[model samples]
Target chain A: MNEYFSDLFSGAKSLLVGLSVTIREMFKPVVTVQYPREKLEITPNFRGHTELVKDPETGTHKCISCMMCQKECPSDCIRVKGEKREGVKGLALVSYSLDFTKCSLCGTCVEVCPTAALEYSQEYELAGYSSDEFRFDLLKRLEER
Target chain B: MTPEAAKQDKHTFVLNMGPQHPSTHGVMRVILEMDGEHILEPEPVLGYGHRIQEKMGEARPWPGFMPNTSRMDYLSAMIYNHGYVSLIERMTGIEVPRRAEFIRVITDELNRIQSHLLWLGAFLLDLGAFTPIMYTFDDREQILDILEDVTGSRLTYCYHRVGGVARDIDEKFVERTRAFIARLRSRFKPIYYDLVTSNIIFIKRVKDVVSFTPELARRYGLTGPPLRSTGISYDIRKNEPYSIYPEFDFEVPVGTKGDCLEVYNIRVAEMEQSLRIIEQALDRLPEGPFRNKIPRKVKLPQGDATFSVETARGELTYYLVSDGSDVPYRLKIRVPSFSNLSVLQELCRNMLLSDLVMSLGTLDLVIPEIDR
Candidate 1:
């Protein structure tokens, strides 16, 4: 009976200790970033969807349409097409589309690109009404940027 | 004992705990044979989160399967990524740079700390404590931010490659990691030990509630904290040193008894040891190329190889049989969670329903890894 009472008293004291810890913490600054009302800075290296890079001097898409990224994609999410064009050094990129619905964002395509023409977009709050909205045309997306 | 036969007994009845329950963590169902509030038998039903992960490994080229490894155990994704990359590097006989090895150790230990923090929160919540999860997640977010700065992904990172890591850590990363370590050390005594570990209610709820001998633990092939709680010092990092781990001076923390409370204490103690490892690696960061020059198409030699790493939960090994081709001929993943969950059958026999939840939570199971 004495041991039981002592156990009961210690348990009650410990419960109050826990309560005191929480009470002290409640007075500290809130760490939560209230979503929709506020936002935190996204890191520069954040892995978003794949996007086509633009050449600094030419102000056009840097993609040479080597087809390496499309071939290397594990999920077959990338599609690229190019044709021989007049006065161009290499085959001009015609179309580069990414089926973002299937893309795993593994960054394999970016790593395999020979000319460093591919990079991850900063568009993280991506929400779409239809599946077609996610099928991103890389050239057009670059032009818009 | 099957559920159908258990229903024939007048004193006992069948109870299905979850195909979707909070305590089970993910989608795991437990078929329980109950005699009132006391559990007679508990059999866990798996395969709910199976994604044909092993078959997927053989379907892709060796490097193409890198992203899939993170999905197996999403909590300790960096260690999983490191394991897969190391397996290929060993089979291909590629020598990784010295700097990349240190970075791998630092990131892997950080991953271990965050994984244990999440487990501590969830385990406490399982025992009716809600406040700790909030504090634990707050600390976990800091580690995620530091990792995302370098790996570029928060949860499922495919940052490691065949030769070495994809990116190098900057001085800013070192600064933030050091600061986070100091902050975590400061919080350990007040928040973790005093408020949780030493609490009489928490100790009473778990201590000596469900315990088994070390022989019984060995019979089940238990690996991580569950096995360590039985006073066995079997950490793969210490016993079988891999990467730069042999250079680091750290001790494998063990427990006196195999109980739920001891498992909890072991995980928390392991976090402190991981902090020591991270600190040592950060101070000794070397300067060199983070990656090596490997061929675009990596073909494994015609042989079999296996590599194991200690993840947050337990030991994870990748067994690969290569046919001198770019694609693996046969790949088998020996996950720790599978064997850890197997002991549930013997561990929870004739325990109360609430204590069963406590025991399961102490296992620190990630259901997707088990089902995989």
Candidate 2:
């Protein structure tokens, strides 16, 4: 009976010790980053969403209508409608749309792009109520930047 | 009658821990013979989920088949990316552009950090200390976000290509990764100290539970964190000095007593060193082409190269047997977990079932990688 009481006190002592440590930490500076009211600064290498990079020269998009990106995409999130125009020498991009629902962010297309016209952007907050909103068209991206 | 009774006592109950146990991580099975609760003898059975990874190197091409290699060790996928890309670049004798090397180093470090963070959470989870998982994952989420911005994948990222990286990172990625590293450095060490290190419950559970002498560690071909824990200062990136690692300033953390806690401390120290490496790599980052100029069709010379990389778990080796064909003759994977598990036969001799679990957990054994 005496031995049992000693064991009980030892257990109580350990529990008290743990509780004290936790209580002390509560007084320490909180490391929490309050979102919205206080936005945490993200790093430069943050991978967000994919975008079609525009050429500053023509003030238009620089995709070059290459179907390589569309074909190389593992998730097949990218869909392109490019055709050779009568006046334009290179293939003109009719439309390039990315289905965000289908995208896995593998970056295969970004790596395969020879023109360096497509790069990943850090705009991950693309959640929406409408399904159509997630179907991001490349032309829309051109206007945002 | 007495002689017959003595022989039956020698016959212990051997339980098979299987290619499908939840805690097994991969397809590894351990046949454990027990005298009641104590494990008498343990035999780790392997090769159930072996997928020929090395052979694909020859079948696909130098950099062409690099994507296939990433699946071997999913937790540290970027490290595999580093190994394959660096190896091909070395073979071609192409000087990786300064910017590309810097970015690669930074990404590799982040991947290491993220991998270790996950391991930290998982290790604690295995030990029944659940709170650290959330804290660790919060930090890991930041890393995933950073990696996703640049490499465009979170978990199993396949970023690096043969000559260099596929695309160049922008200013935003650099700034975000640096900030994330700073926050992680301050936040990480303290939580680890408080939760795992300071807590006597944790220390009592881990310290001296499973012991590994330095001599035993070398014999098993142990590399990376576990080897370092045994006071061996061998790192592939430092000793081999590949892809601008020589330029970076860092130290390898060695453990004094070769035990479970020592192994845990080694990982924590390595993560800090990786942060320093990332900072230096970023400071020295340059501007140039991310991809090296290589032909679309890469035909490597008819030769065999066995490569070893320091992954989160330990040294992962890929031996390629090329037969001058587009496909490989034979591929062999000598995963670190496989060698590390070899120590179990000795480690579990006089321990309880829980001790065995904690020992295995500390090893950070990846099942598929080991099986592969």
Candidate 3:
């Protein structure tokens, strides 16, 4: 009978201690950020997807179509097509397509670009119904910019 | 008698748990032969999450394989990232800067803490406790926020590069990490000790249940916390000191009984040790270039190299064979979960079905790592 009382007392003590933690946490503010209603403030280094950097003065992309990023890409997601212009010795940018579906976003393309033409976009709300929407024409996006 | 009737035993039954069950963590099916609530045999069916990551490694250049390493063990991706980069670095004899080494240690320890916290919450949830996971996630969010500030991704972070980290850590990152350490020490530790570890119901469920002897652990080749719980004290960080682990001073907590409760204790103790390592790394952080200028196309001489790191799950090893080309000739990964999950067949013999769940939960099997 004495041993049973001791067991009951110890159990009650542990219960009180557990309840104290729950009660304390109840007063703390909720950590959930309601998505769609409110979005998270992403960090500066967030890598969303690849984009072509537009040269403000030239009104064209800085990519020389060197095929460096295409070669460096692991997933074979980048497709670059360009040829040397009429009098220009270097290749000019024509059509640059990136299949966002296969791209792993490892920043290798941005790191390997010699002309600093590639940068990561901050756009995070990237959802669409069709797969065609993910195949981005990066040169056209730069032209729009 | 018909073949179907002949195969059916009078007192034994078959039960299948998951491939989609919540307690399986990932898509893994366990085929259990049961005698009315007591498990006779437990056979784990893998390959549900297999993506053939090793075959994918041979198709890409050395630098391109970094993204795939993190997907193997999503909870502790940074450690795997470090493992793959360090493997190439070892083969080529690349000189990683001192600051980069410190950054690797800090982030690795932080990732360890996060992984252990998730396990703690999920393990308790498997045992019918629901409220604790919210608290664990609250702590985990702070870790994700801090890691995201630099690594750029939350879950599957590809942060480490060949010679160094992709980016450098600033004064803000250091200050924020120190603040987090203090918060965990002051607010989180006491609550966990009081509420979960000491509670009578939790103790009754785990203590002296599903014990593994040291011989049994050695026979199964278990590593990390599960092995330590058997009192082997063979931590890869201590026994085979890699990186800057030799500089840190921390105790390897071992258990004599090797039960479910002991596993919980060892994991909690490891979180404290990880915090200590992080604090020490932050204090002695050197100032130098974060990344070395490696070639745009990394070409290695003909050689094979193997490098292993103590990930949160266990020992994750990467073996790379370079045939003097940009792409690897053969890439092999020895994941910890594959060996850790193999012990379950021996562990669940003639145990209650509920005890089998507790045993599997304590082992902390991440199925994708096993499947890979």
Candidate 4:
């Protein structure tokens, strides 16, 4: 009886302390949102990953595929094919493919680009079915809506 | 005179604390010279299992190299991903899309809760409380499920990319996460307070014991949950304001006494704060590109840069140097657990050998993070 009474009082005290605090928290404002009902505003400096930037003037990328991105990529996710053109003075890009499966998104390639054509777009969703699907070609990235 | 000088003799007992001992958590060896049960001089022996991560970083390309960061601190792999991705983004000057930030916030918070839950369970176990472990896991399983659903890996998730996140959130994933967060909050809070906090044994063991002052906290460069507990309202998410943390409404819990109980209290409070941050992120989640547009064929210019992110353990800093090469010239990681472990020498000295376990556990030292 003595132990039971003590236990009850302690329990009551504990409840008072815990609930009163939680009650205070209730009025201050909820920290969580319904999520699907609403949306969050991402900061300007948020880092996601690398993407191909579109040229504002020519409606084309400046990637002549010098293979600087491929050479600088630590993960070797980037695979590029470049050849000298008859008329073009610089090397022209025939193909550029990025394997998302192995890409760490470190931005080594983007930062290294002298053309400033490669930009971080903050578009993050890049899951795929297989290694092949993960490989992104230049056409889709450059021309994507 | 020589005989009189020789009388100044003190006996020492050399004791091996870990590397495999239950208290050290993961492969930490501390040699203690003791006067019976009380530690006289404790020398921390490191490099029992040193993972050469920095060397690995030097070899791998920037984007491909991030998998190794998650492996360093295995517990908070999501936040580890968050840290590394943030650094790469900062160096490269890329911005994550609004939607990507929200997912990062949500996922990272889940990781924080997972870390704290594990800490609570482990800390209790260090104090000889077994039942709490089972209870913690029951709560943790739900979180693991949510994490595994999205990342396709449970423990070490390479979720974040340097430019953005790796995957998009489906309706099912978001719904399940919301449900799990609510359920775990209700369950864990009640059980933790009732089973652990209310227990007189626990209170007696933890309260007014192994106290760390704020001066000491700063001196040792302690960050994360323990640093907040010492009456310091320094949270990197709030102070530094990364991602979409500026929009979130949360409180950084401060404890008057920097004891084990205070650490416990702070972590519990932090779990709530992380929940709040998650809520704010979820509510304001944007719709757009999940990844940023950086062209293929990448290289960074010659530069030396330092990056700091708030990991669950503490402040994880990465210093990178590039010679305009594909590989980094030098890679250095300032891990939280390593600096946090320095304070343990002062804490455990002159205390009973048994309390050392509780002290170490409360600090939440991950050995790989320490050695790396």
Candidate 5:
């Protein structure tokens, strides 16, 4: 009977010890941010989706239509079509579309681009009703920007 | 009685746990034969999360498979990247710069701690505690911030390359990491020990429950905390030193009894050891190029080589066969969760249903890794 009471008291003590930690934490400031209402700063290196970079001098995309990113992409989500004109020294990029649904966001396209035409956009809260809404045309996006 | 006859026994009924259950942690299904609350047999069904990663490895170019490695074990993605990158470097004889090696060790240890922290909270949640997950996630967010500053991804990081890492750590990263280390060190006693470890309820639930022998562990080829709980002390970092691990001094935590509580304690102790490794690696940060210049196109010799690294769970080994081509002829991954889960069939025999949950939780089975 004596041992049982001792065990009872020790068990109660342990329970209270655990409870105290939670009580102390209750007084501290909340750690989580209310998403949508309050957003934390996105790091500069945050990877979202691929975007086309504009060349300042050429006033167009830096893509020479080398097809390096298209060939190197593992997911086969990139489609590049280009045309060669009389005045243009290299193939002018006519269409560059990204099927974002199939993209793994691996950044292989960004790394393999020789002309530095591709970069990661900072858009994080991407949402849409249909998968087709995600298919991005780089030329159209560049023009819009 | 024959196996079929045993199923027809009046006292026994089969219980199916998880292809969708929360306690299984992933898409793992276990068919359990139970006589009331006691489990007679447990059979785990895998391949639910299988993406045929090996076939993908053979399909893509050697360098293109970097992203697939992280997908295999998303919890310890950085360590998986380290193993794959190290394997390629070994095959092609590419030298990694000194600073890159240090950064790899630091990031890998930080990732290890983060993985263990998640497992700790999830394991407790399995044992019927909800408060710890909130606390663990608080710590996890800090590590994610530190990792994102350099690796550029919150999860599934494709940060490692054949010769070195993708980016260099700045002064801000070092300061934040040091502050996090101090904060976590200070919270270990008050938060983990006082709240969870010393609580009588937790102790009673886990201690001496689902206890196994060292022979059982050896038969099942167990590794990581589960094997360490059996007092084997077999860590790939210590047994087979790789990378810059030999430069740091730390002890591998071992447990005398192979039980749920011991496994939990071993993981907690491991988090401390990882902190020590990170501190040492950061102190010896080298001054040099982060990456070495390699050929644009890489090809390996016509032989096969194997490389292993100690991940947060256990040892992850990548075996590749290259036929002097840019693409691998065959690639095989031996994940620790696969071997660790195999023991459940024998270990769960004649165990209480509740104890089975605790034991399975303590195994720390990341099902996607096993299925991969």
Candidate 6:
């Protein structure tokens, strides 16, 4: 009978100890941020999607259409089209399309760009109704910017 | 009744346990032959999460395979990144900066703590405790925030590069990490101990239940915490001493009895050790270039090298064969979960169905890691 009470006391003690943790935590502020209503504060290092950097002086994209990013891309998601303009020395950008569906966000494209044309945009809300929306024309986006 | 008639009269049924079950962790199906609540035999069915990653390795360049490593073990992706990069670094005899090595160790240990925390929560959730997971997630969110500040992604991080880390850590990263360590030590540790470990119901469910002997663990080739619970003290970090682990002073916590409770205790103890490693790494962090100047197209000489690292799950081995080309000739990944999950067939025989869940939870099998 004495042993039974000891067992009961120990069990209750353990139960109280466990409950104490939850009870203390109850006063702590809730960690959950209501999604859709509020968004997370993103860090500077967040890699969302690849974008073409616009040259401030030229008011045009810095992407010389070198095809370096296309070659460096692991997923084969990037496609660059460039044509030599009349009497122009280097290739001019026609369209630089990136398929967001296939891009793995490894940051290799940005790292490998010689002219520093590629940069990661902090656009996290990338959801769309159709797959076609994910295929980004970076040259056009740069023009809009 | 005759023996044949008695055998015919025996009632045994098969129950499918997963493929969509939350407790399975990922797309894993288990065929359990049972007589009432007792499991007679449990056959694990894999391959639902298989992406033929090895074939993809051959198709892409050396650095291209970095992103795929994280998908295999998403919980502890940094360790996988370390393993893959370390393998290639070994094959090519590239010099990784001292600072980079320390950074790798720090990030890997941080990743480990988060992985173990998630396991602690999920394991309890499997055992019908819901509140513990919420507390764990609160702790985990801090870890994710710290990791995302530098690594750029939360779950599937491709942080490590061929020679070193993709980016360098700043003063803020180090300061934040130290602050996190203090918070974890002062605030979180006691709560975890009091809430889960000291609880009588949790102890009653796990202690002395589903225990495995050292010989049985060895026979099944179990590594990591499961093997350590059997009192083998066989940690790849200590025994092998890869990267900067030799510099850190931490004890390899072992359990006397290889039970579910022991597994739980060892993982919790491991989190403390990981914190110690991280603190030491942060203190000893050197100043140097984070990454060496390497060619965009990595062309390796004809050779094969095998590198193994102690990930959160267990020993994750990467074997890379370079045939003097940008792409690998053959890349093989030997994941820990594949071997860890294999022991379930032997361990689960004649055990109660409810206890089987406890055993599975303790093993810490990540299904994508297994299927990959």
Candidate 6 wrong stretches, greater than 4 Å:
A1-5, B1-8
Who wins the DockQ comparison?
A: 1
Candidate 5 local accuracy as lDDT? 0.91
User: Which of the predicted structures, 4 or 6, would earn the higher TM-score when compared with the native?
Assistant: 6
For candidate 4, write residues A1-145 as lDDT tens digits: 9988887777677656555545554575544457668765543333455567777887877887777788777677888887998997688777778877777655557766888767655554556676687677865777774
User: Tens digit of lDDT per residue, candidate 3, span B143-257?
Assistant: 9999999988888889999999999999999999999999888855568888899898799889988878899888988888889998899887898888889999988888888
Per-residue lDDT of A84 in model 3: 76
Q: Candidate 1 on A32-104: residue-level lDDT in tens? A: 9998899999999999998888889999988888899988998889999999999987889999999999988
Model 6 agreement with the true structure over B1-372: per-residue lDDT tens digits: 432343367777789999998888889999998777888789999999988989999898888888999999999899999999988888888889999999899999999999999999999999999988987888888899999999888888899987789999999899999989998887555788788887887898898878788988889889889999999988889888789888889999998899999999999999999999999889889999999988656687798889999999888899988889978999999989888998999999888888998888999999988887
Off by over 4 Å in 1: B1-9
Q: Tens-digit lDDT track for model 1 on B129-188?
A: 999999999999999999999988999998888778999999999999999999999999
Docking class of 6: medium
In terms of docking quality, model 4 is incorrect
Clashing pairs in 3: none
Badly placed stretches (over 4 Å) of model 5 are: B1-9
Candidate 5 backbone collisions, by pair: none
Comparing 5 with 6 on lDDT, the higher-scoring candidate is 5
* Candidate 2 structure quality by residue, lDDT tens digits, B1-372: 232343477855778887787567667888887766677777888778776655545444344455566687788888877776665554445567777888788888888888888888888887887777777887888888878666656666778876677668889888998898788878754666755666666776789987777888878776667778788888888776767788878998888787889988888888899999988887878877887787655544466666777777767666665566534555566777778777788878857877888888878888777766
lDDT of 4 by residue, B1-372 (tens): 222232245555588878799889988899987776777767888997687888988876676667777788988888888887777777778778888888998999899888888988988888886767766776787787777667656677778876788768778877887787687778754567766777665776788778788999989987777787788878777787777778888887888778888888888888888887877777677788888877553676689787777877888888888898767889899988888889888877778888888888888988988787
Better of 1 and 2 by lDDT: 1
Clashes of 1: 0
Q: Write model 6 residue lDDT over A96-136, tens digit each, in one string.
A: 99999999988889988989998889898888899999999
Indicate the residue-level lDDT of A58 in model 1: 92
- Evaluate model 6 with DockQ and give the value: 0.78
Q: Give candidate 3 misplaced runs (Cα > 4 Å).
A: A1-9, A86-89, B1-9
lDDT at A143, model 4: 74
* Model 5 / residue A129 / CA error / Å: 1.8
